[model samples]
Target: MPSQPPDSSKPKPRYTLDEGAPGAFEGETVTRRKFMTGGAMAIGGVATAAFGLPALGFALGPQFEDGTPDRWQDMGPEGEFSVSTYVPKVMNLVADAGEAGKHTVYIRKFDPKRDSKRNADLPYVAISNRCAHLGCPVRYIQASKRFVCPCHGGVYEFEGKVAGGPPVRPLDRFYTRVRGGRVEVGERFSLNSELRRFSVRDPSNHLDGPWQYLYPSRPST
Candidate 1:
């Protein structure tokens, strides 16, 4: 057989860019390599949005919504609490929908004449049972008139002042009001500044003294 020469008459492969087109590869017909790359990129973007959208919503959703309300709950009649003694009470906190949760509080009713320095008008005091050191439940010692945390050696005075050990500040106290012979408890506030001194005149101040360094300014959810 005779050897044939290369067919120079055959049409060579051609590539051209199309005008007025849309997309990352706009204006150009993509090659197999370019098409595969673009497909992978599109899949990656969809996957990222699938996982990222929910995570973003979870982190920032609470910030945009209305915060927890400060609703005063009726504990009971004032007569239920004995004078000069700590009484433990557990109450379920109500939220926007229904019951949020329950918390334990130590309520003390003081005699008006015994401690004139203490607020005579507000004779009732309600303190949180959660310890300031590490969020442990503190036990009240009637003999010593102090709260002792078993987790650590933290101790707090009857007035919720930090008496000893590792507690950065005193136990938090509830805002209280007496109306129609009933005791109403509201939001809890920490004794940040006033924990250093034992005085009813100075109450909890979140922005004062060493509280910024010692403990978190706000409670973690």
Candidate 2:
């Protein structure tokens, strides 16, 4: 039994690099295995942080503010809007919680002549500047008395009814109200079915006060 305790002084095996003469490693060598393990743990920690923060934000982020339209929007007084002309007025719409900046809507004020003859009760008809076909901005041509699309040469009458082009649908009209003689137009909807198919008279052979009277100013509110 005493003879078995004689081999207690034997040295343990040492790990070494490829260019080993006698194994120069002391405590723990800066090995590739240790570095890879640490790198993997660090990457896993970063991934956990990336996914966890958004989940927390989703559960506890700020609530969205309401989106009701403001009542006191700026549209010039009734006198400033002429009777027969479509005057485009630009207004800034406030941004929502998700939006960055205010959105601008081009609201048109129908002149007295057009409003009195066609839309006596309602004086304003707000239509979007965009054309129905290619989403191009429609400009009112005073000489031709039509809304013309610059992109593809689409023509629309005074009431936003399509006169000629590849467009099958007419332009949209907004809901308007005159409060304290200030014309306020809400969001625009689709053009009325009757207005969409309306035909404009040929001005070359007309015999009246003016050819503009034939076109309707207001499309159903």
Candidate 3:
């Protein structure tokens, strides 16, 4: 059997009354009870959002917050660090938190022969000990010459590039400069697999390709 086409010339029923609905009156598109219920629901949703949205934002807003300092931190004399191996040093990440704010940073002299040519101008390589997977502390294993996260199996090569497990990107790095004969570590930044520098991102945030767009860099980065 052939299907019939819809009638475009016929006018649509604009009111419940026109559709012969029970408890409907002239010029009524909906019953009074339904209209009241819909209006009440709309008002309730707006009221809920007014209170809920702000609380939700307050809870999650810190993830996007930018509070990193611009001032450079003194690591030590340039002789303390070498080009071959990473030397771990403790530094304050959060201000005024005492011992709790201290974090471990690995520093080494920049070797132009072994490191990326793009970073040849850098005075030293300062890497954050935080794993890219979870915020777990990673220790540099001299035997394997790799950074291993104890919380997970996330592993990074000597250059901090992810070599295995669930890490999204490489370990973070800090800008280094020589001032007053001491090595000073500047702003913390992130890196891609190719060793390209990017704004600092949280653990598990990807900084390669389109994924980098999702975790947009904050101002503090």
- By TM-score, who's the top model here? 3
Better of 1 and 2 by lDDT: 1
- Candidate 2 minimal-lDDT segment of 10 residues: 198-207
Instruction: Give the Cα lDDT of each candidate.
Output: 0.65, 0.55, 0.84
User: Over 4 Å off in model 1, which ranges?
Assistant: 1-69, 94-100, 110-123, 193-210, 213-221
lDDT of 1 at 46: 100
- Over 6-96, each residue of candidate 2 has an lDDT whose tens digit, in order, gives 3557653354443252534555455566668999999999999999887655433312312223444557777766545577766543334
Give one clash count per candidate, in the order shown: 0, 6, 0
**TM-score of candidate 2 to 2 decimals:** 0.47
Misplaced by over 4 Å in model 2 are 1-72, 93-121, 196-221
Candidate 3 residue pairs that clash: none
lDDT score for candidate 2 against the true structure: 0.55
On lDDT, the leading prediction is: 3
- lDDT score, candidate 1: 0.65
| Model 1 residue 96 distance off true place after TM-score fit, in angstroms | 7.2
Candidate 3 per-residue C-alpha lDDT over 1-221 given as tens digits, one digit per residue, 9 for 90 to 100: 99988577988689999877898899888888888999999999999999988766644554566535477889999989888899998888776889987888999999888888766667899899989888799999989989999998999999888999999889998888899989988777888888887767888888777676567565443
Residue 134 alpha-carbon offset, candidate 1, angstroms = 0.7
Sorted by TM-score, highest first, which candidate order results? 3, 1, 2
State how far residue 71 of model 2 sits from its true place (Å).
5.6
